[model samples]
Target: MTVHGADAVDAAQSAGRTQLVVGRSDIVTPLARERARDTGIEIVVGAAAPAPRPASGPATGPVSTRTDPTPSTGPAGRLTSLRAFMPGEGPPPPPLFPPSPALYRRGAPLPAHVRIDTRAVGGPGSTPTSGRVRRVTVVGAGNVGMIAAMRLAESAAIDEVVLVDIAGQRAAGIALDLSHSAPILGFSTRIRGVRTLAEAGPSDYVVITAGKARTPGMTRSDLVGVNAGIVGSLVSDAVAVSPDAVFVIVTNPVDEMTEHAWRTSGLPTDRVIGMAGVLDSSRFEALAAQVAGVHPRELTALALGSHGDEMVIPLSQATVAGRSVADRLGSGTVDALVDRARNSGAEVVGLLESGSAFFAPGLSAARMVLAMVNQTGELLTATVSARGQYGIDGGYVGLPVRLDRSGLAEIVEVDLTAAELDDLQTAARHIGDRVGALDGAGAR
Candidate 1:
């Protein structure tokens, strides 16, 4: 009872019946009939049976001529039968799956099962290709860098992670410890520790987090010179070996270091970015919750500009329970909240007394890596090079950017008040001074 392709013709020849049905309307009727006769199977072109009407209808009035019974074994029989059963032209072929309301609401016109023929649509290099991970290397072995390497090894997306550090033994020990945990975690990703920068070789992504941690007495400006020098050296080595790998800068004075790395490495601007504003914004959200007396998850806040005291926290744009915080708390309370937001990092360091915050910073770095690996193209605040964006130029600063596998895609611009603008400019000047100082020291 099952027929397939040319085998259907053989089955017809074996059967005593001389009739064949060609369902394809595109095939010329006469041509099909001829082919059927040549194959010794008579073509029944229009032998479809007519639909029966219900007998319960009253015969009160004269029936129209259109309702007349038609013969079922003529050239027009199929068309007549189709007209009786289906009023208009027969229904078009059904879609493979039912439409999803959610998808439709989101502006996706096609159903989930509607397959696109990439072969037909794709030109030259437009076709989708698989990615291979031959070797993975990480630059820096500080808190963010270590976490990035560990997370990358654990990710199914990459194969291995080579952890590099100035302190070689410490890096090796960390790698060894992470390697031991892999067995219990059920991940097969390999981890290696490299003493010399050259040992890491070419990598898919070179994450930089090797500078000193921020202390309570210091500002990001204070850490700029030391971190810039460290980042500059790391960038030089990383670019020499892994020219194509994306560079993620997570050092303190992130904006300055990121810019220095870009300039030092001579890589494209898109390849160098700093991780800060995302973490800072998360802190802002938490603080907003405390001020509003609500769960942190329900509060939404934005922290823009430099990742320091001069950073801009837009209270006018912040909201809780679908209402602006400015409206809820008025101007004075909002100003206090902004002050709290600006000093939260120092507050955390004061509370710890021994170390700066790590969990949130580590999580922020991991999120950036995940966004890149997944090609999600999500918009987040990261320190990136600027060419006259928001009236700032020739520097790196925290701004919202769309990130994906290709690195920074686009920068999002936000409105700033006069006071916020002044603060940001001051931060930029402070960073510029530190960079100048480092250059002078290097010259000496």
Candidate 2:
């Protein structure tokens, strides 16, 4: 495989070249891309050159006279004439894809070959009903917040997404970039950026993702004190303008942060939800699917309670193709999957050595927003007030919650074994202690 490094980019820049072309399979280094961006160099992917053909005849001219005893047939040999393929050096390359068929004229009758299906597939009609637009305010321009805003905008369920960050320029840049992709991505949802929450008023949902990210060797609980203040302040300010908006907290130590947001906003217990359980459950499902040799989308898994070590993954509930995970993969594998899922965030953080996971967490938050905006009433695991459920009281715990336009519609109680219930309660108590300490220490 071809390896594209920063040295090659520097060489191209030194040669006064504005573009660097590499094979499609070439491994482009991150530093190369960064350098290219800094130097205004456009990196283009090109097709691999054809293998060298064996000599057909004896040496005839100077071109065929000088031949090395050993010939090179690697990337270097293939790229010896790369400049021939460069723009303005030769004829234009062939089209990568065939042109789309001209089906019909705009303003003309339906084409004879086209037949429309009158059946209703799903969802409400395309446009918002009565122009009752829905808006979501994402508080943060961090990795998780940026990805969450992108996912929410792509969903086409919300009319607008406002990204709020203290770094106003960064937020605006990200918003502008995402907005530019809307036409190409086939989504019309508007994306905007602002420096303060006041500009994001009357939002239907406020997703709280502003907080310290977990670094290597740092546990989610380690961020409790630092994130509580940030999340609490954002939630309090969010409620001032969008009092009816549901608050989805994505800050670290999410279970405790959900409680903090709830208290700060003084909203109903059902309105403030944490974004851990869904992400944890998705991880569990993906891991279980890998072990069971099945597609992850076909597996149903639930991870509840705290978003940290005490997170509970019940063997009785997790299933693949309607079969219990324990029965399919045995208890030992289930245990391993549970442990992996519980520590997946830390695993990513350790690997990155910098930022915690954002892709799954962001999508998880966006999924909750989509459920709320579309009023799908889908049952998803999330952290909500558990004052009387599972014999746990006075804390926000992760559980199966049905979401709709009204936010939390119902808390679905599933039958868990005694041990599973104990584990869940253990997680709840852990979150409770951390949350209590936040208040006791005057964190927010």
Q: Distance from true position, residue 2, model 1, in Å?
A: 46
- Could you give candidate 2's per-residue lDDT for residues 1-444 as a string of tens digits? 465667888997787666677753344443454455455455555634342222552112221100121111111011111111211233333322101010000000112222222111112334321233479999998899999999888766678899999884888888999999887767788899998999877898999899999988788888887888888788878899999998899998888889988888888988888898889988998888887887675466677888888888877766665456788998888888899999999999999998889999998998888766654434578999986788987789998776766688777677788999999888888888888888999877
Q: Candidate 1: TM-score?
A: 0.65
lDDT of 1 by residue, 44-132 (tens): 22343433223642222322111123222111011211111123323432221111111111111212222222121112222212243
Badly placed stretches (over 4 Å) of model 1 are 1-136, 183-186, 293-295, 329-333, 415-430, 433-437, 440-444
- Least accurate 10 contiguous residues by lDDT in model 1: 98-107
The root-mean-square deviation over C-alpha atoms between each candidate and the true structure, in angstroms, is: 17.9, 19.7
lDDT of each: 0.60, 0.71
TM-score of each: 0.65, 0.71
